[model samples]
Target chain A: MIEVRGISKRYGNLQAVDNLSITIEKGHIFGLLGPNGAGKSTTISMMCGLINPDQGQVLLNGNAPGIKETKHKIGLIPQSIALYEELTALDNLSFFADLYNLPASQKAERMEWSLAFVGLQDRAKDAVQDFSGGMKRRLNLAASLLHDPEFIFMDEPTAGVDPQSRNKLFESVFELKALGKTIIYTTHYMEEAEKLCDRVGVVDKGQLLALGTVDELIEQYGGESRVHIKSEQGEESFMTANPVNDLMTRLKGLTTVENLSLQRPNLETVFLNLTGKQLRD
Target chain B: MMKAVVALMKKDLKLLFKDKMAVFFTFIFPLLFAFFFGSIFSSSGGSQGLKIAVSDRDQTEKSQAFIGQLKEASEFRVTETDEANAKKLVRTGKQVAFIILPEGFGENYGGIFSGQPPEILVGIDPARKAEAGYLEGSLMKLGIKRFELAFSDANEMIKQLDFSIEDIQQSDDMPAEWKSLLGDYLPKFKELTELEIAKQPEGSDSSGLSFGSDGDNPMMPLKITKEEITVQKTGPRNSFSITIPQGVIWAIMGCVIGFAISLVREKTLGTLDRLAIAPISRTQILAGKALGCFAAQAMVVTLLFTIAYFMLGVRFDLIKLVLAVLAAGICFVGFMMFFASITKTEQSVAGMTNAFLIIMGMIGGAMIPLFAMPGWMQSISHISPVKWAILAFEGAIWRDFTYIEMMTPLTILTAIGVVTFFIGTRMLKLKQS
Candidate 1:
């Protein structure tokens, strides 16, 4: 578990992160969603002890993020592919494993598990330069898990990955939660947050606008679900303020109705309603 | 911490070996330079021998004999040519000097009995003053020998004249005119004929002079004998022997550039940040890089010397050579770190490291021997690491310096390495921020 308390960071004239605070519980996927320059990365950087905050502090369990004990308990997977291109995948993994001071007896077994987890066991001997973007992303994820830290911080780990690789990453995240590991993931993808994150926090301009489960967020600021109908004569739509059963009974009595569908409130609509803009904008 | 350092060093070495260009520049390029320079210097058959041209215009026995003597001397490479050609050769630097014997010179040649000896015309290159002076001294010795051969009985004549002149002055029955004329003339003659024999030239025979009270063919009172003592254990010194150490310095320089640029490359590629995120300290990363560079340079120095030992007949003290190589390697690795810290990009690091190495090489006696440099430059060369490196290596090689003598350079180099490494690491930490 991690706790960030009212942290703010400034770069010359711009306030990158403005008095931001959040709490991540154990064994859950906490997604920080925002557009470009939303201070998401700046906040994550403070939490990882990579940079200092101007106004507050971050605590990992009980100690500060930079303490030796806390540093060993967490893992950071940066947005860039930081593996050596000239070395084989296995060699690259082995190098990071050594840095963590893993035991000699456990090194080979951990490397095997890591490569398999990333679905790169067959290409373990190939140089990383020859890997595709998605493959490299998978390898980057695998490297962060080599030490099996209790907490993991990922910054846009699936930014450029393909759909299939994205699905695989989702499965891996679910599996990590199943193993009782805490993960703080940051991204601008609304659908990924809706599907993968147990709890989501919408942030923009160094401020967190909302925080709750998917259903709670949709219920509060998401407005209402609408019924849309299109016929030969004209097209009509209706907003269901109360119950969807009364609207469905009314729609069945009209034979003129051609196309009918329910447009439910989702994270994208909730973000738009909350910030008056799209999540990606 | 040490485990992390080793892991980092292993990764760096793997990347270096994977790059063919890096391996070639680090190990093979210096060997090529050594071979080229060695062949050029050795082609002249060492620095002791002088090339000269001689023209026998007199064609007399004495002139021909002098030419033959010069040809037989191991130190001279004598060539026979006309006066015009000899002068041209000397002027063009093809020969050190031109010796021309005038026609009828040997026929008119005289020793002390004659008023003057025929002069041997020597047209020497002004730039080659040392070689010209050596040749002039040789010819002077030859002239002295000719004088002894012509005036073998001159000492006996002088002794007989001393008694006769005294008897003539003391005679009582002499004529008035004869006495008056002999009296003035005898004093003048005594003053003119008073012989004070000078010391003989070295290696010259002293049996001809006879001036003793016993009158039994008086032997020469003084004998001058020349004996040459050389300090070198080997027969003679050569330029290639000294040049081998200079070549090793160049190889070390190559290592400096190779390893220094690698740090810049890693920074640009973002791998340095990745390393930072790992559970290791900044000092460990720097230590890893320094160790890697040292290993690379040490290997290169050893390889170059081993090749020189077999191909160029370069000999060294094995233990001293190993120590010198290690010291030089450490010093340059520190230089590599310092260079990497100041530069931001690979291109900048490469350009700066090259300029630094070249300037140091020129001032430190790699491009030219320190002994041959001007006094001011030699004094300033002490500040350069390359200078210390060459000194240490030469101590191991031909200089045959004792351990105490070698320690001066080794200590200075190690000190510089330590200071530079400290400064470099501090700068690297600043840059990381």
Candidate 2:
């Protein structure tokens, strides 16, 4: 289990992360969603012990993040493709594995397994600078899994990745869950989180405004469904709690309607509703 | 934990090798600096000896003997020519300087005991003033040989003694008491030498008094011989030995600058951030980075010295050189870390580190030789690590410094390393995400 309780962080005058809180159980995926300055990376950095919280605490199964045991079981897949481009894939993995102090006996096995998991085993000998963007992304993922830590933090893993690679990453996340690993994933792609996360937290202006399972969050903050019709009067749309009943009753007198459609609320709708439509830098 | 640090070093080293510019600057560039500067400062003529021209206008027995002596000295490449030709040679820079034995030089060659000093004129360009001094000194040394030989023969010594008696008797510059004293003693000395020669058995060799062959000249007083004193082994065979340290320091500085920018690059590339989350403390991460730079510096120093010793006639004490390399390593690694701390971007680190090193190199006597700098600038070199680093290397290579003497430079380098590293690490620890 991982717990972030009333954690807050400030940089000069900016409140980068407010007193936000979340808990993740073992063998589950928790999505941290936010705008550019919503403090998603800052929260992940705090959780990974890369940055210290000014107030409150983060505990990985009651062990503070920076403690040996906590750090030993934690891995952070930074959003950027954080890798030594001049080094071959195997070399990069070997270096990171040594840092984690994985047993020498298991180093080769874990390295080989991690590479295979990310589908980069064949390119292990190639320098990362020669790899495609998607391949580097996969190698980046492979690097994080070398130690097989129980708690993995993937901060925008699909960022700038092709769809095929994104799907591959999604599959890898699912596979991580099946392997009984807890994952804290952050991304701007709502659909990705909608597909992968068991729970999602929506934050804006350094504050967590909503946190729940995908369906629950949508039901709680996704606003309403919409019904649309094109008639002799003109095209018209209306929001309703029940699109089926509202569509049937509101469109009964529309004789010359050429098109009809219903819009159902989803995570994107829930995200926009909770964070507002204003753009953030 | 050690393994982790080693791993980081290996990665950093691998990256360095992959960088062609770094390899060239670290290894090849220093060698070039040493070679080019060494050739210029070391005896420029190398095996051809010091080039000089001789214009023997006297054309007399003593003048011929002086010229012969000059030719026999293998250290000089003597050129015999007329005064006009010798002047042209010097003016055109074909020769360092010219020795002109003036018309009356033969008669006045033995002028040491107060006939006028012979004017063995030197025709040289004023720009060659230092070389002209060398030419005059050499000529003077050769001119004294015939005078020294006069004592080995009774007739020659008696003649010289008689002339000296007359010269003193007629001299106005001599104090009255001195002239009176020498006027009385020279005759007595001459009479004693004549009597001694007459006492020798008939048909004895022309050397009236022989201490036998290959012995000190009993007649000659106050013989001075030159010797070279170094701390241990034969020191600096040539200028190459002196300039090798200069080149090595620059290469080491190159390594420092390269690693400083590398650290900043890692930051922007996000690898540093990734490593920060590892179970290791921030110190270990920094240690790993520093170790890599240190290793690079060591490699550069070793490579340069090895090449120098095998090919360039340079020599060094291996143990002392190792001490020097280690001290320099620590010092520059601190520089790398400190520069990395203050510079946030790769461009900033590159620009700032390079500018700082170049300035330090200038003021430190690495880029510019200390002797060539103004007195105040030379004094300022004391504060630059570049000066100390070069001094440390010189101590090991040719200065033949004792262990105690080596401490002066090694301590300074290490102190710089420790202070800067401590401050830099403190700043790094305070870095926010």
Candidate 3:
């Protein structure tokens, strides 16, 4: 388990990550969702030991984040495609594997497994610059696994990837979770978080506004499901607690209805309600 | 720790070479720079002419006069010493060469018609044997002027005539009849020389006897015999030998700039964050960067010097040259680190590296020869590692540096490397904090 206790970070006069805290369990996919300038990257950086927090501390399994043993146990997949573009996928993995100081007997095996896990086994010999955006993202993901890190911090892994590549990345995240590896995924896309996160944290202005399971947060902050009826005369919408049962009763009185649909509260509605719809820098 | 550092270094080198322009600048550009500048400096002796030592065994009026003429001429920088120390100066590479006038040089200063001409003995450093030819040519020019004066001066004319007559009388090589006739006619010529002197008013016009008004031949020539000797190994035989080092420094600075920019690139591109999060300490990351730069610089130095040895007729002491390259590599790596530390972006680094290196090269004699710079600039050049690097190279290659002499540049360069490295790493840590 990884625990961040009241961690805060400041840059100049700006509080990039305010006094905030979150705990992630072992073998869980925890999603962190925030708008731009919401301190997601800063929080992740502090948790991964890339930067020090101005206050409080982070502990990886009851030890400091950057301790010799603790650091080797965790891995970071930075938001950017951090793999070396000039090198082949295999070479990139080989380099990271060396940095991890993997045992000689297991080095090649782990390299092969990491590439295979990303579905890039055959493309290992190709330069990363030649890889598509999705392939690059996948390769980026593979680079972090050479040491078989227990805790993986992936920040905005699917920001600009196509739907197909995003699916591959999601599949890989699922596989990692199945293998009982803890994952902290940060993203701007609410749907990606909705699909991948076992528990999601919505933050704004360096503060966690809401935190719960996907359905639980939605039910709490996502108000009023609605049903829309399009009739020959006009269109109408009715608010209800239960759209399925209420729409059935309302539709029986509508003889001229041409189309009917139920609108249910979801994560986006919950997110907007908790963080507001204001634009962020 | 070593494994992580090595991995980082290998990765850096791979990426650096993968960029074609970086390879070109790192390996090829310096050679072109050296060649172009070498061509310019090859024929030039700089603001100062070639330094030469002179010893007059004849302490007579004409010898004094000849030495005076040498001092006035701009072609040779004259250093007058006794014959006892002339060879020592040349052997120790103090002066380019030394010229010695024999005991009878004054009496036989110029006697084209009076038999053997006065001889000037030249001792030149063997490593710089080509300079002997230059010294000889310069001496001949000074000799011709004295030869003209010898014929116009009445006393010099009488002396030459008498010496010729005495030579005929003493000659066993001359036939009896020819000897008698020449011996008889030489005195009459001597009488005419005195009468001609009587016709002249004073020392205002000392123009020598003229056969014709222009381009006339009144033969009075000085014989120059060159002897090459030195303790130094083969050195700069030509201009290219000197310029090869100039070229090498450009490439070295190029590597420095290239690596510095890459360091900033890592930060800007977010790669540094990944490395920072790794288990290895910050020291190892910096070491890896330094090693990558050193490797690039070493490859460049080796390839360039090998080309110089085979293609440019340059020779050097291998041990000293290795020391020089190592010191230079360390020094420039510090420059690389310092550059990386000061800048935050690729554009800024590129600008800083170019401006900084160009200034160092200018003042250091890497672009302009130190001999060509003003005295003030030369004095300032000591602060530039570029100058020290070149100085170390010169000591190892052509300068015939004693072990003690080699220590100056090597020590200074190493010191610069260590100091700058500390500052650079310290700055990095401060920024991280």
Candidate 4:
């Protein structure tokens, strides 16, 4: 568990991370969403112990962030592929393993397990310099796992990776959650946050504007459900006429229609409504 | 902590070795420089092969002997010719200095030794006064010795004449001996026509020195070969050898520029921030990077030493050489780290480091020999690490100084390394902020 209390980070006169406070429970996947310049990255940096907050403290497992003991238990996969491109996937994992002070006897086994978990077992020997963007992303994930960290901070791990690799990353995240590891995931991709997060925090201008499960967010920021109507009549007539009334009456007769939701607003709509702009700048 | 540092070091090593151009400039170029410069400067007397032209108008045994002596002297390549040919060569700049001997010099000398005074003329170009003067002076000194010998003979001949006069009187004063000496001495005495004239004045006219004609010192030749020696011989002189200091300077510069670029690249790639977030301390990250650079510099220094050894026979005391190299390597690492800390891009570092290197080389006497520089300029060279490294290398190998002699330079170099390293660490705070 982590607790951030009155956290603030100021850059000149702009508050990148305002007086923000939040609590994260163990084994839960948390998502932080915001538009550009929303201070999501700054807050993530503080959480990873890379940057210190100006006016507050972050406690992890009842200990402050950046404490050597606490840092040892956390793994960070930055937005960029921090893996050494000149080294092999295995070598990259081994490097991080050594950083965690893993004993020589267990380093190889742990590195191998991490590679397999990312489904990059066959490409472990190849240098990261030769790997594709998605492959490098997987390797980045593997690097974070070599330490078997209790808490993981992933900053848009799937930003540049293809859907196939994204799915592979999601599977790994699931596996980590099963292992009871807590995760703080930051991304601008709304669908990813919607599908993977157990709870989401929507931040804007360095402040947490909204926080809860995806369903709760959709309810709070109400948006009409998307309805697709099909009729045997000409498309122009259906478009011109009020088909919504007839469709609603007929759809109410079917069990699927009766129980159907009026597109309980996708994360993108919720994000746009909250920040008044696109998820990506 | 140790394990993490090692991992970072290994990663940095991989990066450096992968870049062939970096490896070449960082290590190979320095060695090539050392080898080239060392061999050229490592001659026995530090003579840098100078050209000299001699005009043998006398064509006499004495003049030929003098020319022979000139040829055997250190650093001279002598060519003999007539006055016209010598002048032509000098005008063409084929010769640095030219020497001229007058005709009838030997004939005059023979007469002078027999009691007649003789004169010889030598002409020299004023344009080459500095270089040509030294040779002229030595030649004149030789002529003076010969003149003294001739004078002594004349005095002895006159004394014999006095003894012969006394021999004729035979008054227990050895008068018969005096007459016999005087009878033999008068012919020789009558043979003495004039004082010997040597070395013509340096203008177009052959207005030779007239020793007997002038109311001046009789012993002084009417025309004395006046030579002046300039430019003292002290240290090595040659492009190959003189470039040692420049090479050291360039190597340090290369490191500063190279690592700064690496730092900027890592920053652009976002590797540095990522590394900072890792559990390892910042010092370890810096150490790993610096040591990696040191490893590269070591290879360069070693290559330079090997080439210099084989090409120029520049021998070094192994232990002192190693110590000097170690000190230089440390300094290079420190300098590069400092460069990396301050810059935001590799281009900036390369440009700034190159400029800094040129200034250092210029001030440190790397581009020019310190011996040729003014004292104030040489004193100013102390600010450059290259100067200190060059001093250490010269002391260890060129000067062949003992361990004690190398102590100061080595200490100074190490001190610079330590101090710069501390500054580098302090500068790294910018990254965090």
Using DockQ, give the best candidate's number. 2
Model 1, B74-111: lDDT tens per residue? 66789999989999998888988888888866654532
* TM-score: the better of candidates 2 and 3: 2
Residue-wise C-alpha lDDT for candidate 3, range B1-433, written one tens digit per residue = 8999889889889988899998888787888877777767675646577788899989998888899998988888899998878888878878888888888887667564556678888887667756777777888887777656766566767777777888778888878888888978889978876775666567545355443335233444533468987865465667776787888888899889989998888888777877887788888989999999998888899999998889877888999999999999999999899989999999999999999998999899887766668999999998888999998988887888998999999999999999889999888767764
In model 1, what are the clashing residue pairs, if there are any? none
Task: Give lDDT per model, in order.
Answer: 0.81, 0.85, 0.85, 0.73
TM-score on alpha carbons, each prediction:
0.78, 0.79, 0.76, 0.76
Runs in model 3 deviating more than 4 A are A278-281, B36-235
Which is superior by lDDT, 3 or 4?
A: 3
Per-residue lDDT of B401 in model 3: 92
TM-scores (chain A) of the candidates? 0.95, 0.94, 0.95, 0.88
Clashes of each: 0, 0, 1, 38
Give me the candidate number with maximum TM-score. 2
CAPRI band of model 2?
medium
Model 4 misplacement above 4 A: A226-264, B43-88, B97-129, B138-265, B294-330, B365-372, B398-407
Displacement of residue B354 (Cα, Å) in model 4 is 3.6
lDDT of 3 by residue, A147-171 (tens): 8899999999987799999999999
B69-142: candidate 2 lDDT, tens digit per residue? 88897667999998898889978889887888888887677543557766777666777666667766766676
Candidate 3 positional error at A4, Å? 1.3
Clashes of 2: 0
True contacts kept of 2: 0.83
